[model samples]
Target: MHFLTHNTAPCDSTFSPLYSVVFGCILALGLPLNAVSLWTLLRHHSLKSPSAVFMVNLAVSDLLLVVSLPMRVYYYATGTWPLGNLVCNLITMLFHNNIRSSAFFITFISVDRLLAVVYPLRSRHLRTSSNAWKAAALVWLLVLVINIPESMHFSKFLKELNGSSCFPKTPHRSPLHYIQPVLMFSMLAVNMVCTALVSWTLSRRLNDSARVNNKVNVMLIFFLNLVMFIICFLPLSVGILSTNIHVRPLICLASVNCCLDPLLYYFCLDAFWKKKEDVDLPGEQQLKDIRSPCVGLE
Candidate 1:
């Protein structure tokens, strides 16, 4: 596993220009879009819907992740982690939290959709925003608690050794390595299960045109989530599989997620998608009314 050869070393970027560009794009674009999305989801929309509440939190988590990427940019440009040890722990926690929380929120959204379609009558009570926020709150608390070890156990530069090369300086804390794998597997597992449910419900709903809009939204969101899941965790998974064996960073492709996530936000700006329109009508007047700055979707 990568943990053994990892040697708690700092990674010097031979790919600085590449990663710098990528991280910069994410920082410049993802942060603002995610923040606006969060604001729209919170103040502008009625959080009484479980789905909306979760979406709001999802935006918040994504924003947190976006905000943290700048540090990565700085590291890439400087080729050293000048931020000190405490920042290392915070950055690790923030990155993992954003990824895990996003996965769970997507899974929750998929399941909520499935129930609304598969069991409409039962959904009224179960899908209330109050309950949705409660469930999302519980997930947030659990994710925070679970990642505490990664945050606290995190070790940075021993200073005396590998001063420039930063890594998981887990001093006598080998248990920390397990944290990444555990979180990765847990997220992938949950996403798989929830995605299956989303597929099943969407299949049934496909027969009815009235449901197609929501279906499209869910499908797009699901696909977006699946992509994010793969990108965010696959490298970590590969590193774990090869036992972190590869000489180079396993997943350089993950850099695309920054642009991709923002595209999802632009997708949200679509009137049909945001309002969950039953019909895809082409009326500038109607679309404009719904598309106008977020105002608690009815």
Candidate 2:
């Protein structure tokens, strides 16, 4: 999806193998991680917390990208899109939508943590599970609205290619292309602010062991969110701004975030990796002891 002038030349042979290998790895890792994340969120009733709700939505977004990778892997490996135009458009849209939705959800998680850590009592009313669900709904709606035109633009196959090319470099730049960099940067800024505030809050609690530990956990959540933005979304945003940079490899790098997202789930949800028995143990005291830093259940 690098913006290039419409030309008949086939995609760079060198990058095709790279895409196949990278996308294959993403599919292999992302599938099980997100699957288990989703399962844990539902099976344990983790959705009681707003952060858990966002985590569930994030896992779903990652799975959307994971399931679409097989076809992308096939196309890159064989240099053809046997799936045809409709599927091509769909895959393209899914890729973009996943990227945008993932960014938004990750930011939501960070903001959830910020509220939980910095303004716990005050934000309690705003951080309800219902509000989280509403926020997730808005993210999906915004992603769909942004990608609709891109899907229409992507509907046509590149006829000049030797065979079907699902995402050949197109010379024409859609207005949406310009919007992506701005969106990525804005999300990055939000994550950074959340991370900073969480870190500062942690510093204030160093003398109290339990509160410090809890604040550290909150810091870790925001830190990972910032890292995801920098590593996954930064290059693609930069690539979108500069035509001289190759965007295909950046896109592949961006896809790596799908695998990395499970880390957020593990850290954001205290019950994500805990045994079912442990999570189900009786008593509100036990639950409070293990409450996620993002939940501010205390």
Top-lDDT candidate index: 2
**Candidate 1: C-alpha lDDT:** 0.57
* Candidate with best TM-score: 2
The residue-level lDDT of candidate 2 at 199 comes to: 70
TM-score of each: 0.71, 0.83
Candidate 2: give the clashing pairs: 4-171, 5-171
Model 1, residue 230: distance off in Å is 2.7
Give the per-residue Cα lDDT of candidate 1 at 8. 37
Residues 112-223 of candidate 1: C-alpha lDDT, one tens digit per residue: 6555544555555676767888888898998888776656555533344344544332222335445656666676677666656655655554445534655566567667
Candidates' C-alpha lDDT: 0.57, 0.72
